[model samples]
Target: MIVSHPRRTIISRHEQFHLAQQALRRLDRGTGLIALGASLIVGAIAALIWLQPHLAPVPASIAINLMTIGIGAACLIAGWRRYSFHRQLRAATAITDAPMIDCWIENAFEGEPGVIAWELVTSQPDGTEVRLRQAQLIDPSLVTVFQRAATVPVRYVPANPTVSALIIE
Candidate 1:
């Protein structure tokens, strides 16, 4: 007797991978720009006050500078949080023969300690669609990344697709 096993699906990630990489780069770049801009604005004002002969305007007061620095520090903290969160998501303890698929977040909700519920979507080569349900314990530190990113690359074993991990970290 002859038997045929289902051919494993072949998914090309050339464009998908680049697109995801570009998206992530854009996110980090934006975060950096925000922090940098905030710092530059305050720095420019302070330099003008110090370099000029006349007294600067009230807007350049010490209180204003402190407030501006506070805002910039907050942005830096949030950016750090996002970077760490992505790192954790992509960190894997072991390797497997799981296939990576591009997926989008269908929806998300939060509860105590921020348990996030999201449905991951994928399109198969056979014109079939797959949506896998997933949930993770989300902490406040990681919420920044989740709130900013919606596309999550996922890897799963063909035998047991129910258990999966995020292709992030």
Candidate 2:
């Protein structure tokens, strides 16, 4: 009789962080551009208000323009904050070094379509056991893949072992 073991897949924390940062930047870049466009539109509206006839109602025009400017400013601020967060995530990922471990699937279930919850357990270098339960949005069919995997890869920061992520790849 012959028994063959399944191949194991491991991902370094740096790679994971890089993937996360890229995803975040991709999502936020479009949002930031849209916000900037809105800001430009607001500026154009203010210019139009000033260019209108002198007999035009000034108070109402000023009030509307002020509101538009306020909204535009808010959008710009939000976009800047998102970009800042992306940079911070990138920096953190560059500095973090987490160990990869083999984790066995304890249980798995689907909360909704395209979402899976995985309960995993792994042992630390010191012989301590760590349990991580997380839910992620993925293809509904991936539940079977998780079940078939002999062992899943997990990475956690040494400083905060509780903060862990299930390696999807």
How large is the C-alpha RMSD of every model relative to the true structure? 16.1, 11.3
Cα-based lDDT for every prediction: 0.45, 0.46
Best by lDDT: 2
For residues 60-169, write the lDDT of model 1, one tens digit per residue.
56566666666766766666665654454444343332222223221222232322334455556675767764544435355445554434455544333444455546
Models 1 onward score TM values of 0.34, 0.41
Over 15-53, each residue of candidate 2 has an lDDT whose tens digit, in order, gives 333433433343453475557758666685866566556
Q: Which stretches of candidate 1 lie over 4 Å from their true place?
A: 1-53, 56-60, 94-169
Q: Considering summed lDDT, which 10 consecutive residues are worst modelled in model 2?
A: 100-109
Q: Give the TM-score of candidate 2.
A: 0.41
Q: Locate the minimum summed-lDDT window of 10 residues in model 1.
A: 1-10
RMSD of 1: 16.1
